[model samples]
Target: MSASLYLVAMIVIPAIGAAAVAALPRERGLLAKQVTLGVSLVVLLLAVLATAAFDVDGDRFQLTTSVSWIPDFGAEFALGVDGIALVMLLLIGVLVPLVVTASWHEADAGPRPTRVFFAWLLLLEAMMVGVFVATDVLLFYVFFEAMLVPMYFLIGSFGGPRRQYAAVKFFLYSLVGGLIMLAAVIGLYVVSTSQLGEGTFAFDALRQLDIDPEVQKLLFLGFFVAFAIKAPLVPFHTWLPDSGAEAPIGGAVLLVGVLDKVGTFGFLRYCLPLFPDASRFFAPFVLVLAVVGILYAALLAMGQTDMKRLVSYTSISHFGFIALGIFAFTTEAGTGAVLYMVNHGLATGLLFIVVGMLIGRGGSRQIGDYGGVAAKAPLLAGAFLVAGLASLALPGTNSFVSEFLVLIGSFPERPVFTIVATVGIILAALYILLMYQRTMHGPPRGVLLQQDPAEPLSGTGTGTGTGTGTGGATAASATATATRPAAPGTLRVLDLSRRELAVVAPLIALIIGLGVYPQPLLDLIEPAVSATISDLGGTDR
Candidate 1:
């Protein structure tokens, strides 16, 4: 197979699938879901093939294929991948299948049209791949903005009770950022015209232009504001928590897992390369916001009562590290940021799946509603614990490696920021353990702890001298409820269902696998990272 074939297939296959899914008869509910799953898997295969075809050690972008789209404006239907882009493609590829699997029965959840949900997901995947692969700045912006349509509907139509609000908030924030970015794209085109005698949005062309320092800062702000909103640095991060909490598990997975990465990807791909002086000039201010985000978001996460919201806050905290790594201007820090994006997807994606399971059983996302779940479902508890540990960057987990690299690589260049960000590590432990202890360790509220408890508990579980909880069943004792009958009116909870296990098993393996052996990914990422740093005119500190 030709190299362009893999890159082209990654986008085309999903576009074709979206069309096919949209054409499916509404009556064929199962067929719609199955077809979407199959297409996602095929795209994933293409991603793997693309990885195989990618020249990881190559100094320039590989598999580049461009065709004129607008000769008058100097735009084209161009595509290619650097090692960084390849990693992102692979991340999206892996996440899409799992998202399809996680949402296998999601059509049954809300009142929206099931076929539309599947179609939108496929559409989102195509655009995401396009964003990562596009070589022209205009094309990137187009995909960047266009991808929002599917996600907006995905949340508004298939999300929770507050879905519409979250969707609109997400849309408005993104639109504002996008409009700002449009101005920058226009600015770059003008610069290209001044330098090359005709306007162009080609990334390579823009990189070659000699831009004025003042103008570079202006253009960089336009781009930085958009990416910051998307990277969602601190003050600009409100939409994320709202969207993550309200969207379906599948949407949340891509929203937090993949879509958000576009912001950071834009930084590495566009900001640094196109405006090196502006990047260095702005690094200190960006570093300050990143450090603040790491602490502020972690504190907020600790105080959250809702499970999804807590995880969302943690991601914000994690993004702080990603941003810190990028601006730290070290190859190690940048590579760690890239790896962190991939590993964050695995750890947090798994966390969302685990949270979905809990919500499905508990019927509430409130942390106060659940307790002592480990006694009822060890498999589920164990999986949740693994995800939690990964999120906290526990030793021997994938997150540990990335987090360690970010801090260590950043210290020499930005010692103060690195030290402040390190405090998030302790905060991570506090929040992850707190959520686990409350949800998995305490006496469960709704289900029987075991086959039977020593004594059948009465209403509210007050027999153990505790107040009432949400579900019909309640238990306050650690060991007293193992043999008691389920409280009247509450359903007995079972362990992780087969389908649920299928969704999370691969992620668990990856969390452990990458933690111990991250060299493979690092090797691919380091060259690309070195190239990005070189573009920024920086040396590894």
Candidate 2:
């Protein structure tokens, strides 16, 4: 297939699948999931093919398809992929199947299995593809802003107790940011019309039209604010923890996995290339904010008691690294940032899926409620540990390579900021270990733990009087004894089933693979990033 057709297929196939799934009878939910997975796998294969077809030695943008949607206003249906966009597309392709697997059990949770859940998920897959593929700034903006709809519904309709509130907050923050960017989009269109003799929203054409430095800065802020909100950087990131915590695991995965990257992607795709002087002028300030966010979010993560919120905070911290790398403007850092975006999607998406499993088994997200789960559910705990290590950027994990490259790339230009950001790495270890200790280590204390009758014994006995002196021992002992158990001290609860394993195993494999061999991803990203830098008058050769 032509690359353009591949791009269209990425959006269309999932959409059609969503509609088909929605129309299926509730009893055929299994068929719906299978169809969703099949479609997602096909999309992933197409993305892989697109990657293979991408010419790293050639010009910046490749395999483009453009057609005028509205000739009068200079809007068009445009699609293309640079290395950065290609990486994000690959991330989406990988993540959606995992999300479908993660949510498969949810179909049986409510009174009636809502095929609408799968439909929204598939629809979201299409929108995310559009966001990454669209080359026209206005088209990008439309896709960028339109993404909130399916996501909002997914969260609100299928989410937890405060789903409505979290969903509304998410929508409002995104809407406001998009509105600000809309003004900038309008401004760019007008400027292009007046100066270039015709209005155009094509990214290449817009890149050629220079605006006043002051106007450029304003436009940059307009775009930056939208991206930051989407990236959910530091102060703009408050909505994430709540939304992530409230949304179902599938929703949380996509929110952090594919959606958040749009912000960082915007900076690289639009902010740097379109407003080069402003990017340079704003670099130091943005760098400082990025470092501050890294440390701030890490510190917040260290104090989180809710498992979901902790993961959310780590995402903010991870984005801080992506921002720092992008604003640093070095080829290595930029490439690392792009890779970091992909790594975060994989690792963090796995983390959320695993956490959801824990919540599914334990009936609570409170860190203090779980203990000795590792003994009972070794497979699940192992998956969680790998994901956590990836989050902390441990050696031999995917995040470690990207984060190391980011720091090394930024150090020469922004040593102090890089130093501050490095502390976040240390804090990451602390919070992740702390979270693991709380949820997987000591003893099971919550209602879900009590429900497990055959709960195994690991380091210590399952009795309350083991005197480990941990936070949850007493509560877990009491809860465990209270629940129905086949034996006196053992509780039988479900562990990671084959389906759960199917969802997370690929992520773990990729984390290890990418950690070991990131060169291919880096090589592809470097040429396009160099081209971007050359466009900004930074450097390419």
lDDT tens digits, residues 1-541, model 1? 6877788888888889999988988777678889999999988898888888777767478888898988989999899888888889889988888888777665544565578889999999999999999998999999999989999999888776678999999999999999999999998999899889999988887888999999999999999999999988979999999999888878998999999999999999999999999999999999999999999999999999888889999999999999999999999999999999999989999998888766655445677767878887899899999999999999899999999999889999899999989999999999999999998886556444332322211111121212222112332332244334467434455677677788889999999999999998888888989988988888664
Candidate 1 Cα deviation (angstroms), residue 170: 0.3
RMSD of each: 6.1, 5.6
Using lDDT as the measure, the top candidate is 1
lDDT of 2 by residue, 360-408 (tens): 5555567765677787788988999999999999999999999998999
Q: What lDDT would each prediction earn against the true structure?
A: 0.84, 0.83
Against the true structure, candidate 2 reaches a TM-score of 0.92
CA displacement after TM-score superposition, residue 407 of candidate 1 (Å): 0.9
